[model samples]
Target: MTREYKRNGNVNLFACFQPLAGWRHMELTLSRTKIDFAKQMKNLVDIYFRSADVILWIVDNLNIHNPAAMG
Candidate 1:
């Protein structure tokens, strides 16, 4: 006998953390498109770290995490 499997939609997680500041932000998005990645970055820059002179990010090798995606 074989067992059947069920599947559901996917949710992408975009998490940002500032360990020194003890701050964090997490977004749950339906798709992991370039636009979504851009939005997340925009939120980080325009809202979260607006006053910082420079912001550094450590990201995985996701296709959407590249510089081209910010366009």
Candidate 2:
């Protein structure tokens, strides 16, 4: 049997993609908690679409991806 390596910490990359615009924004965090995800999303939106009337974002089915996190 092979030995298993366990890690206590992990890095997460939060990214937003705009296919039509050919652009993306990314943020790295040590944890993928709700607060961290929300902060990353807010930063990206504030930097890229602050002046826009509406912005649409798509994301995978992550545990932290929910309305509570966004709020």
Candidate maximizing TM-score: 1
Q: Tens-digit lDDT track for model 2 on 1-71? A: 89999998789988778889898777788888999988877877687788889887788999998999987
Error of 1 at 44 (Å): 0.5
Q: Candidate 1: misplaced stretches above 4 Å?
A: 1-4
TM-score of each: 0.90, 0.77
True-structure RMSD for candidate 1: 1.4
Q: Candidate 1: deviation at residue 9, Å?
A: 1.0
User: What lDDT does candidate 1 reach at residue 27?
Assistant: 94
lDDT of each: 0.94, 0.84
Q: Mind sharing the TM-score for model 2?
A: 0.77
lDDT string, candidate 1, 1-71, tens digits: 99988878789999999999999999999999999999999999999999989999999998888889987
**Worst 10-residue lDDT window, candidate 1:** 4-13
